[model samples]
Target: MSSNFTNTYTIHMLCANKYEDILTQFSSPIEIEDLWLAALTEWCHSPTAQCNLGTNVPPNSRIACTDPWYSKLRWITLGYHYQWSERVYNESKVGEFPSLLYGTTVNIINFLKHLIEGREISSNNSSRLLEQCQNYTPEASIVNYYRTKTTMGFHSDDAEVDKEAPLVSISFGPTALFLLETSEAIKHEFDAPLHGSFDHVLPIYLHHGDVVIMAGKSRLARHAVPLIFFDDDTEVVSKGALRVSHNVCDKIVKEDHNEGVCIHCQECLTYIRTTRINMNIRQVMPVHR
Candidate 1:
């Protein structure tokens, strides 16, 4: 977990045992987590299903699934839905955070504490690190889907009130080139000439099952995803790995169809092949100490 960047740790292949399970939960047609996706036909009738697209569609408009909305899908919020325009989380537009995701985040935080304790650090430092790990709460998440050519620009996640809590980022699918820079370093670079070099930005390669934790001093660091490697060997989903309930499968296919037929799983695998999914989880509120 050692990293060149202070307070930034990288755990390679962190979710080896449960990677497939995590992917199935998100990629399967049966949505396990309550995702607030824009223009999703199933949620069109709900009051919280306001579309984020810059289209002329009414607030409660019911757009057909046949439209090319899926291709336009980029990101979706979970639990506390973030208002992108305002860069804030609305308390009223909140939902239950996924149990599986919450458990995984807690485990990672505990593991981080264990790693710190094993180091030859002072007792005071070790105690402070343990306290930070124990105080984290997974309150919200943003699931971002990236195509091969897609890229995220440099930005700092400063909307969350709980700055001390670490921001855990989990990656799936092909590897990506992630650039990270400290807030102070970014400010100094901005003062330089227009064509000045950016030598302080650290490039991190995030692969499938990799986890990045931004905590302590690096909590508000500016970061971006400049590129994603199109690796054919990247395992998106295994055959028969997705466990769809019988009732849910029935809704996907005809009642008289073959017993083992599952079109949903096939479509899910195909979509994941060319897409990279990143689950960025964080605490939106201060911990009541």
Candidate 2:
């Protein structure tokens, strides 16, 4: 990551209670449109949400959905909100985790369990896997939005209270160059006290719909998104939109009740052409603790 390039982003936090109080804090207070409020409340019992749209902008300025602020949104946090500056999850800021995301993550973990047990996932014997996933609860998520020239610096996800649980990451939109490195490799590159191997670094190309699991010994491995390949191809974007448009439309429809007010798939196609979205989910609390 370039030290000179400032990381611009916004955070949408799910707050189950005090929805009205939180909204009042915004300089130019905005309501959580009815549809979104309903969806959030239904999925996580969060009646309100909080959004921090960077420090550079005027706090009292009313931000429209089509404003430049939306494009600058880099990340959103759900469930237990993470304090980036402090590198810790605020226990008091917790909210109910989204069920849909949790279910999807559980399914992914089940597949991983089958691989570990030396069983074919297609064998349809998921009873054992389902039982194992019962222990994994997704308490937090970081949704990263990457635009052109956006990059994530090398870092380890050690803020969670439980480091043993697997970390799941889902990718969408354009492809990105993901770099995974060992702790020793990071030390060597930074010229830290211990001499480490540079060979431990691995570069991976992640395309849309790809899932990455960091578990076992690699749970806290250092990783980074060094680059994103934004393909301006219309066909590619259209296909990509088709893959996620239903979910997007569903959410939008729930947020607005207007009979004809709906975001078309074509709008999603246009958005896909310029960005990549990554959903990084993790269990922030220890099950045994």
lDDT tens digits, residues 36-133, model 1? 12213233333433334433233433333233554566765667888898999888978666666787788777777766678532233456556767
| TM-score of every prediction relative to native | 0.66, 0.64
- What candidate 1 gets wrong by more than 4 Å, as runs, is 1-67, 120-126, 183-197, 235-266
Computed on alpha carbons, the lDDT of every model, listed in order, comes to 0.56, 0.55
The digit string of per-residue lDDT tens for model 2 on 1-289 reads: 2111112111111011100101111111011122122222232223322334533332322222234765776766778988878999988988666676777677667656655466433223335333434588888987787877889999999999987677888665677888777543332335434434445665566654456667655668787998888873434334435434433444455534333335563354355456677878999987876
Question: The CA-based lDDT of model 2 is what?
Answer: 0.55
Q: Report how far off residue 259 is in candidate 2 (Å).
A: 21
Q: Quote the lDDT for 222 in model 1.
A: 78
